[model samples]
Target: MSSSKNMSGGILACENALQRLLEGKPVLSVHVGLDVSKITASIVSLEAGFDRGYLKKSRRAHLPILAKIESVRAEAGKGSNSSSAKKVQRLEDKVLLLEKELAMVRTQRDRVLTQNLQLWERVRELELAERQNKTRQVRLHH
Candidate 1:
């Protein structure tokens, strides 16, 4: 009957709702109609870009908790064989993409290194030729 007891109950309900949201469950509450899809969109928008807009700035405090939720999801996948297989496939695809990028970068680095060495060799040869010409000129003068 007391106001303090009612306030405590309200706080407990909010905490339960948050836990359900973090677990990727649909929260069906009459007072708060929180859609799971809307929350997912909000989280994705906050993390998808380089710019920190108003939504991102306001949601910045939730990033750590969301990251923990992701870890929990990954752990949960292990319990389901099909979900674990899907997760593995996604990870493998990412690894393949990174490997391709790494190979391209290595090829570019090799090309640049070869060009640098060739330029240095040409400079050395030119310097040798210049020294030889100076020597001949000095002998002729003498």
Candidate 2:
């Protein structure tokens, strides 16, 4: 009885995962506690109303559902691909804008540095002229 309960639980989990996948939700095989092949088999089994014997006897009946599943998966892939491309393009545009801003910042920094150097040079020249004036005054007093 315990084993049966566990089996039912696993089947229930597999069914839920399969339903999510069919609904275009992200459902990995690992999430369902089953490998890829097992998940595929479980999907067919679940679609056949948990009748494995019937599934084996009439595999054709489940083919249409399987095809539909495949198409849904393909469409999802395409949708993700397009969205990913859009994101990449947006990032590239942002990078270009950042690069331009960085260049402008660097140019401003260079200008400020040049101005600071010029101001320092002017201070040194003023100090030198003041010293010369003091020397002349001392000569006149002597």
Candidate 3:
């Protein structure tokens, strides 16, 4: 093959590799002796918070990466159930926190309402006293 043809082939291969990497698929090749390419990574197969170092560093990159991972031996039927369990736990925690805050706010509101009622009663009492004192003075003068 001519040099130009060889260069064109190389360019095509590089383009394909870049496309796979951008699509978040590993650059898997038989030459690598693995099912997945080591450079590309996908978060779907990985458990949350497993690769903190890689996550932190690659977070700034524009293209998605695919990482090669070995098939881990997992217990039977354990995968689907554990995800739901985690979601339920997180929601329960949020609900509990909200309930506690609601209760405290209700208590505070009740106290303020009670204080307002007491103030209204005090004002009524003062008005009644003033009327009675004024009537008594008028009768004494007459």
Better of 1 and 3 by TM-score: 1
Question: Tens digits of per-residue lDDT for model 2 on 35-54?
Answer: 23233544545543454332
The 10-residue segment with the lowest total lDDT in model 3: 67-76
Candidate 1 yields a Cα-based lDDT of 0.57
How does candidate 2 fare on TM-score? Answer: 0.51
lDDT of candidate 1 at residue 2, scale 0 to 100: 81
Model 1 pairs whose backbones collide? none
Estimate the lDDT of model 2: 0.62
Order of all candidates by lDDT, from best down to worst? 2, 1, 3
TM-score of each: 0.48, 0.51, 0.43
Q: Candidate 2: deviation at residue 71, Å?
A: 8.5
The reply for model 1, stretches above 4 Å from the true place, is 1-80
Q: Give me the runs in candidate 2 sitting further than 4 Å from their true place.
A: 1-5, 14-77
* Model 3 pairs in collision: 40-66, 40-67, 41-65, 41-66, 41-67
What value does the lDDT take at residue 109 in candidate 3?
100
Q: For candidate 3, what is the lDDT?
A: 0.51
